[model samples]
Target chain A: MNALAARRRHPAAIAILLLLGLVAVGGAYSLLAPKQAQASVVSAGDINTGKSLFLANCATCHGMNAQGSAAGPTLVGVGAASVDFQVGTGRMPLAAPNVQAQRQDTSQFTQEQIANMAAWVASLAPGPAIPGAQYTSGQNADVAQGGEIFRINCAQCHNYAGSGGALSRGKYAPSLTGSSGKTIYEAMLTGPQSMPVFSDSNISAQNKNNIIAYLKTTQTEQQVGGMTLGNLGPVSEGMFIWIFGLGLMLGCAFWLGQKAA
Target chain B: MTDLDTTGQPSTDVVHLDEGHHIGTGGLPARFEDPGLPTHIHRMADDSPDAGRRAERQVVALFGLSMLATLVFIVAYFAIDKSVGIFLPGIGSTNALNVVLGVTMGISLFGIGAGAVHWAKTLMPDTEVVEERHPQASDAATRSAAVGIILGGGEQAQLGRRPMIKYALGGALGLFALPFVVQVAGSLGNPTKALAGLRSNLWDIAPGVSPIRLMRDPEMTPIKASDVTIGSVFHVMPETLKDSQHVLEDKGKAAVILMRLDPNQFSAAAGGQRAQAWGYQGIIAYSKICTHVGCPVGLYEQQTHHLLCPCHQSTYDATNNMEVIFGPAKRALPQLKITVDDAGYLVAPEGFHEPVGPSFWER
Candidate 1:
């Protein structure tokens, strides 16, 4: 009876052992593999097309090899993500260099052309890749968590309400109320202009989603207790109340006194 | 009362005052007319006994409603679950407790005001009397007369004689003033506790125990010295902060900005020696909070090594021990002394030597 029971359990135990072995082998392979092997797959955009696009649009400032010149900084390691964000948002191919680069309404290159140029620049050296389209989708966004994260990280430059505020010199954090999800996410990933880069390790994909959700909610929500007064905060609100609201009331009181007499 | 004619001329409405002639200016006409107030109209409650009684009952009912509303406010303060919400027609969902408290409090105040106003308009004295203006300073006889009138007025109002009114007014006034005092006293917590809270943050290094490792802000990952490249900045916090209950409060005081700068860039005159001794391989950490008003000093101009506070435009020179370069800051940001452990993780051997953040720490 004991021999029969042992033989029956042997097959089940062997199957479990085989599964564990397979997992261990896969884990080992992933750990031991070189980083370049994985990176090559992501950087496989057509080199010829990328080079031509870069030369036509970006070579005037970025140089023939996408290297640094007197006009602009090197695009060598800025990556496909940076190129997509800059050119895609019309912030690059800058309209005459000033204190800061401003976002324009029209893009000089098509989305495909921008991608090809970004690929060429990224081919020089491995860097951050373009985030997926679903990265900014409000599907799994958590507004409460996003609000907390935004307050911790972005509220310093962007106002609490995302109305944006002044930075050093002439540069300012642009308002997010009218910004699309792609613009907000791309801005965070790329840093663009004076803004600091928030890496995947720093914010994570889920955190970015949360921030986008929070921004959307803030944009949609109505300001309670009447006027927002430009959302510049209490100083402006106080001035309006004292100068306009109180002044009107005082004028009415004077008129009533004159009528009574 | 002044009445105008069809031709817009002043008529019987203009009445001359006897006192105006004596008070006339030397060069001007010795005549002046008194502009009297509008004629008084009697309310129904003032003339009819039944209407007066009805108005008195209505005032009592309003006061009763006010008392009931005050009871509701008191109950709502403690009994209601603050997080719950209620839905109403035409209006979206809102905090139930807030609505209840606000409505009850408003009605309580409004009832008192409305009751007092209604009493004055309908039941109180209706006759209109005018008094001539007099000089501010009074003679001895006039002062005595004023005191006598005041005493006589108190008797006429029957407030002094009515024990019920004296007790009711005393209770009402006394209770009405308590909420203000309670609000003030409750808001002001223990001063010593608050001061002590401000004195030290979450980074506590006990002797013989290992120092707290530096972790990245928000991410809370331990950082290695090799990770910091020259001209790069990392917003840092103490590793122990990960398990802290008061993460925000401690983070505010303990937040540090870690940066790696070239050793050659350090000027000899401005705390160069001290900075070199404290830092490990040109990597130094300073409190990110501004010395002016405790805003996060995040903006770093890499070329100038200047940390600027956008709130008030206060700037600090990071190259020379974070000296105040421009704007309102009175002192430098507090520096955190750090070193790498055996595992290559950056750790603080001890907490900040001085309290971090605003100039209030100096106190």
Candidate 2:
């Protein structure tokens, strides 16, 4: 005990004790802590390629380390789904800085290039991943249930028919008319700009597929009634009636007022 | 009559009426010679018997067409299947039954109208008649007589003779409206009581009672802190709401929007700091009711941390203590002080400090 007490006063003793404690805690944590769920297995070579691609193409605005700069937000934990949504949808490599990034018909990068970039971003931290094909396919999904979920959660901004709507400032919820099922899944998973994230826990994969199915059904569904009047509900219908219907009435009245030939 | 020149000067020429002409009381001619209607032009049917017979046949044909259209309408109603769709050139795809029924009905109504109008123009009397219009107002004596009769009736009832009866009747008639006024006012209930109800919600915990757990809206499942990830939003309601008698009413004031954001994202200002301190880790909850016009502010932009009310476009900065960043909302959205319970489920230890939703006079 006297020998240990003498050694305890040594300057290196405290450092040794702290090191031992750290190792013990780290070892225990590694052994007992729950493992983070990874969406897919990615190789180190893919990650390296992704880093190189990011550094070459995105480093100007996102910084060399992916830390945010004055012009762009930090992409450290934004995840692979975010990259897929932004790059896959051609919203990134922004044409120019504006209120919001617009979706383009053709993406700047190919699918393989986007995957490499997503892998690199995913390596930085844990986040949402690109959803599986089963969940995004919208095959055999319950359209009715999906419709109910959509009405309660997404109808406010996306419109009842997914026609899109205006937001504050210059922002807007883009129309979902021709969006791919994969793009829709990623957008919901990542909650890209001006959109709230509906996490996997909030809306299960099955339900998300259901929502996709409902969207697809609506896009393909034929309008049973005559003219939809732009599907703007009562406002456009009212305007059409006022301009065309009333004009027809006025024309008939004028014809009646004329003397018979 | 005097003629005025274009140069703004009256001309010397003056025309006068004949001395034999008589003036009425109002300085108008007492009588004017009738100017007969313009010479009637004979129609083809009016000039020839064969043409008249042809006109009759045409009218009968229009009437017969109307009857045929009516019969077609009945047949289409029974024969056409409701589910069948047809492609129209301009209208696109439409229900076959609806189109057929509408067309038949329109034709049926148009035939009758056209047949009657054609008969009147070609076969009926073509001569025009003149009808004179009299003045609209009654003469002065007749109007005075009406007033006198009303006054005499009142006198017969002793309304004028007895001042007390006249005044009493007026008071009684005026007071008769009090019941209706009272009924309307009473139906509105007490404003103070209603305000008190609005001020508190299901989150309110009495002393010694356990805090209320935040449950998922619609699903009513309790949420653990770990389930909430950064950038995720949850629609929440107090667990106590499930057992309440007035579920919808309580839900209106108690509905909350729970969101998880990075801790570093919160502003360093006092409001932001307070918001952070009141939250659990990076998760924060706020009343979903907009401080504008009581709309459910559900449009949450995860990147911008902006909560937008679908109505009125009221935008609230979620990272800045729910401050009003834009729109007509006068105040910030009230934050709900949330913390996890023993089970790690999110709970509200206390209720909102102020009322939720749009401001009222009492607030």
Candidate 3:
């Protein structure tokens, strides 16, 4: 604190001290607490009716505790944000199990029902709740830094092309061409599917934003040479060369080497 | 008297064979033996006893030297280390084993050749050979005679009757042959243990801790909820590999991909239209570890919102549930459920919904 701060502190010392103490506590809370976007409130009407609707509709497939069973993945730690993203978009209430989960229409869950389901999921595990579908704060913190971070962390499996690849079994890691920074951050906040959670501890908010900037900047840039298959760097690119490109080259080389002169 | 057969000198030079002849005298061969043939030059050893004994001893010494060289080759083979060279400050490091073994093997083979040539030159009959022209096909009688001639040569060698000479020659030849077997097999016995090292990598991020929080690799930094903007993508991973023995140095092969999308755009589960609290506001994380052969799936396209695996152009739709959109990968990247910790940094709510790394289990 400067001289002015000291003077300000001395004047209504008790209240100022109390205020300072509160700010300190807030800082600590902010560190641990999810600094959620201060979006508009969920209407009283939706939440009030959503409670009972949730009990009746969702208790069967998902456990009453909201812990997943044979029919579904556990929803204990998943937040309303995920619920809104999944249900509001109609990816939930899947028609059937398959290689990839598909998005469908949202008429099945009424607004109140959707709210209640989100609340019920929250009851099991309190996480980032989804506001309607509106998103702000798409601006990233940095661009050049993000590129460095991406190269070190994401280049291995995701490839330089942003093309996804296979993992053990049928699981795969997807690309991030047009995804909003909010979704990217939330996904980090809440690991959905097979993606692990990259907590703020792992990658600071500034670093995450930097990564976002890198992704956005590169999207529209004109690629120098046209073809970039997988871009998973060596593993994928090498395979293409070995299987098709190199094979063709080798064939030509063999012809030249054995030209019967 | 000496337990040895004494040879009778062909030349009766008991008194004097003058300066005109001191052994190795030449004479024409019988006409029936070689018609119009050159003279048969007689050597001093054929007619003199002392000179022949001297030549025999010289051949034995050559064999003895060969046996000594073979012994040294075995010593060198067993002593050299086939270990990788480490950097040293001043005197450069080279493959010591290669140099030592190469020199020893070279010496071993060279000595044998030199000794054999010496034996032929100084001990064995050095006279030029001339074979009579005959039909290619041999009669049984001639075959038997050839076998008899070989047997007679073996007797002449006295490999068995001369115990000292036989043992010395055999020892030399036997030692020469043994190092070859040792040379090839000596450096090949440690593979079973080495193979296991390549199989199971040190990527386990610890145990008991579910959903090891994904952290930015290398720097070990944390991600914040407020930082990510809409229409942006971030590649992320767990903070600490406490649940497993995850090492940062190995992240080049094990990182994951992350992106955020509009909630409305994201597909809901069959459970409802409302999205699960999977994202803070709409952020999602996916394994960068490719589902197809485990390549790191990256190079995300912000416009198309596609995750592309550089390996085979496999794309994953982030708007959907990370389903494979294109290319060879069969499944979506495993997702790690996450939530904010007390410090507001994103942390794994639980471990990955599915295992991480490659499709190691066809099972």
Candidate 4:
């Protein structure tokens, strides 16, 4: 209203007020620097939050303490590897129990939430975390040893030929022929289907790497004298040997006798 | 004067014979009746006294050869170490003991046969007799007579009383069976069945320990939450399985498959339902071990959301409380309630609701 009052409320005063505001913010930041000033590294202490979320959503089956109750397994030491593989891909909080926990879209938990949960789980049983999308451990796996182990432990189900096999009911052992190392690693880590969990306690990470190496070797070396027929196994192999090899020999013998005569 | 001139030329080769008798030179077949073959023959042994003695020797020799062959067969059975690979040059077969036993046995048998043939042809009484072939089935009289012949032969041999040769032959026969006995009883010592089974088991539900992880076979790495995608299938286990600590082996049965699904589509497990706490938002887990035979029920169909077992084709409907959807499995796979721990990893909230793998009769 008055000319003098208007002049006093000028742009300079506004600029000075802005400068004070900036200084106050800078001072506050400096005071709290050690405790609150970290980079965008998001290793939040969200495990407590995750634990609560787990009890609310997962405890019904998993139990309140995550110790496992009726209709669930004991989660004493499954590790972050299992947690990440299960929830990261939305296989956890399964739609329902099937031949296996089928992988689907629409994860219920966010990546961050899942991470928090993984951290908590890892605390219980510290072990291998989820493998990266491409697990490229260039260590050469011993194919012969792998084959022997495969035959001894996995052949009955996955098939000696790696063609995979059926399980009781409608379940089946999956084929390892084309699975990427990541997929294989995740599958082992998560135990997504009717598969049981294999903690690092069960199979060492090095052993897993060796197995992957062997798989790679086999994927390349599968070619042999023709007509594998999915290698349905010894019975089929025997059938082929008898039908082709022995049959030809018999025919030759018969021809020879006739010619001699 | 007439007889004196001819009498000087008396018979040069003449042998007297009885009424129905004949003589043979037992020389080359060219001089014999049938000239095709010059068979092994006996000379004066074809007649009386000396002939009988020769016949006895030949018969005894044949039996003795048979005994020797059988003995050799037994020796060959035991002589070859099983680890040695057999190589046969003359024949295609290559089993060491088989070849050696077979050759020795053939030689012994051949000697026995030759000895017997020599005895029968040269020394057995030479009288021509004929018997008529009749019906396929022998009459009672014929059968009895045959029995009588056998009995008569045995009696003539004085087998029971003589004891020495009889006992020796018996002992030889008994010894011939020794190899088979050794094969059966001796081989029983090595039982690989139990060992092989333990070597390849999928579940290890023991007691008082952490338990082995239910790891995916081949690549047996432990699982984490982030790796599983919705509609993804996983074969899982505990991390404890890889540990060297013996105690973890006890609770291997606790392995479970944790999965998440859309909660609305999921069906609660059947059988007098209690609290609807078997699953989470959609996450549900079950034992990988089959409830029937212990094959891992790992085949998962994402669209159908079904778990299929390879062994007997048992199916588990994940949305329906892990119930038996198909195949020989009598019970549903045991479900395990699972959740993320404070650190954001997958963990079983507790042990399985029921025993894993096969449902025991005791259950």
**Which candidate ranks first by lDDT, i.e. highest?**
2
Q: Write the per-residue lDDT of candidate 3 for residues A157-233, one digit (tens) a residue.
A: 45455565555345555676656666566665555555544555455677777777777666644333323453456
Candidate 1 per-residue C-alpha lDDT over B132-201 given as tens digits, one digit per residue, 9 for 90 to 100: 7988898999999999999999899898678899899899999999999988987997777877777788
Superior by TM-score: candidate 1 or candidate 2: 2
Candidate 2 chain B worst ten-residue window by lDDT: B1-10
| Ten contiguous residues with the weakest lDDT in model 2 chain A | A36-45
Candidate 4, which segments miss by more than 4 Å at Cα?
Answer: A1-161, A164-212, A219-230, A245-261, B1-228, B238-255, B268-276, B339-345, B359-362
Candidate 4 or 1, higher lDDT: 1
What global local distance difference test value does model 3 have? Answer: 0.60
Model 1, docking class: incorrect
Please write out the lDDT profile of model 4 over residues B49-153, one tens digit for every residue: 765676678678788877888888888788887445443343322456655676778778767766756665565554545577887997899899999999999
Lowest lDDT block of 10, candidate 4 chain B: B26-35
Better of 1 and 3 by DockQ: 1
Alpha-carbon runs more than 4 Å astray in model 3: A1-45, A52-59, A88-90, A99-116, A129-140, A227-261, B1-216, B220-363
Note the Cα lDDT for every prediction shown: 0.77, 0.85, 0.60, 0.62
Writing each residue's lDDT as its tens digit, candidate 2 over B1-363 gives 112133344444433676555542332344554656777788888888998899899889999998999999999999998888888776666788888888888888888987887788788786888678999999999999999999999989988678998888899999999999999999998988887887888888897898989988766889899888888888888999879999889989888999998999999999899999999998999999999889988888877898899889888998899999889999999999999999999999898989898998867
Reproduced native contacts, each prediction: 0.01, 0.53, 0.07, 0.04
Best by TM-score: 2
Indicate which candidate wins on DockQ.
2
Residue B265, model 2, lDDT? 98
Clashing pairs in 1: B1-B13, B2-B13
